[model samples]
Target: MKKELSAIDAKYEAQKIAFGPMYFQAVVALRELGILQFISNNRKGVSIETIIEKTEVSEYGVTLLLEAAEVLGVVEIEDEIVKITKVGFFLLKDEMTRVNINFMNDVCYLGAKSMTESIKNGKPEGLKVLGDWPTIYEGLSILPEPAKTSWFEFDHYYSDNAFPEALKIVFRKNPKMIFDVGGNTGKWSFACCKHDPNVNIKILDLPVQLKVAKANATERDLLDRIDFHPINLLDRSQEIPQGADVIWMSQFLDCFSKEQIIQILENACNASSENTTLYILEPFFDNQDYPAAHHSLVATSLYFTIMANGNSKMYRVEVMKDLAREAGFEIVETYPLIGDSYHTILECRKRA
Candidate 1:
């Protein structure tokens, strides 16, 4: 898989990698200082003088960022006038891009600096930046301000859009009981309650997260239909509750190491009847058609390595398929691109 690049372009790309962090900060500075917004506001290119004056940024700051932006292709400059480029527009207006940027800036930026140490130690060394937690999930309920919001927004944006289609697939067989492993915020369970009046969802997650989900269910008057089961997936002694028509794990398994994934799946299998179906919804990086989506997943895999958990990652479709198979389940069906989302849902059942 050789990349096609001219000698000059190859050297330039190497330089871009060398100054990657600095360039990232330049983008942040431009966005935060309102330079990008100001230029975008005025469709016609604005003079350097106008940018400094209108953005209220110091001339030194304005000139420095503008020059960097020009080279970064975030903006184009001609005759001392600065204008937003297509890349800049996406930075400013694309929901996915904005969410990724904010998530990185607020939750991952500082911590990401410690990724090397995290890899070396086989632990989330970066977790210290947020708090003294063993994993990010432990502190989700108590994360300070923007970090908490950024984490959930990043989490939901990837999976929630696939909920409608996921609902159709899960309830099609008229499942009466669903076990939502890692049912953060009880979102999928709430969706299930609404979709099938009689369906009961038993949420399996940490107590801290379940507290928030339980509160949400109570507020929605669906508490009666959803039950909370506090069990840490890392604790192998805890058995998943039995008698489920369907076992649902959405964007969940990627949070654990391969060995841990198999352990958890064993728990699910022990709890499941032969007729039960297991639905796993994950956005496998290599399974995607779009390069952007693939890149995002790879970046997220690094985030998991440095921030979420040390050994987990956004596994490839084949990797997950292998994990499922190793755990005594076969992927019976696959529903891809659910609702035009990046996710691929694997419908599994016990191997015969």
Candidate 2:
């Protein structure tokens, strides 16, 4: 391990931590004001005068934002010319970064203010920023504008890319019926139908989400192959339907607390027969290859706590496996690092 920071260095680090939100806002301002893009287009570095003239922002405003960005290392000012750095490039053009920035700014930032309250009360106190709901999912249908856009984009970003490979795994046995739990927008169910014409899908989710999912399937002329079941799995009174040869949950379990996850899994066990296979896809934090991936997963736990639900988190592989066993399921296979994605597939069956 490296040496601990000296008192002076520690103070500097603490100041940076205290100013974290301001730093993020500066980055956003740089992008919003078109200064980063202007410098990026010039490439040879643009003078403050030129940026002010080009973007039409006041010189004082431009200078203040760029100066802050220089400290953040997203830009550099040398010989009075500002140049965009690699970090700036990621902020401007990287898809993941773009999605993350928008998601944080639009979906999580304001609600995050209620984090302390959420933690104290074991509830999504931050969710008040959007609407009055126990969790974000109930409010997803009504979430406004770019917040809605960013939310779905962030949600799909981590799970969508894995579908092609996961489809292969799900269809390996050519199951006749697949139950898609938490089938948001019906993307997976549509993919399932296109992958196999003979297979039909049952989508189980909240009524609001089911309405959207059904509309999506109808627009694609795929509704005939997909059915909808609107139920709140969080309610212990609700039970998953039976007769699905395959039960599918893609990036779904992380929305629930550990106890809730076990309860849902147990309900799934009741819905399953010996021949049924339950495929769970998750991006377990510890199973990630990169430290950044792990960091993002852990940070997302707070989002769940403050915005989504009060108790769920991006779980570790061992913790999830234990939950599975507790729910009377036996893991038949574990497929890690599924196809250029940070997801793992657990193939499970009912316990004997």
Per-model TM-score, in order, reads 0.97, 0.98
Candidate 2 local lDDT, 193-243, one digit each (tens): 989999999999999999999989989998788999999887889999889
For candidate 1, the per-residue lDDT at 22 reads 94
**Per-residue lDDT for 138 in model 2?**
84
Candidate 1 is scored at a TM of 0.97
Give all candidates' CA lDDT scores: 0.91, 0.92
Name the runs in model 1 displaced over 4 angstroms: 1-4
lDDT of 2: 0.92
**Which candidate should be chosen as best, given TM-score against the real structure?**
2
Distance from true location, Cα of 88 in model 2, Å: 0.8
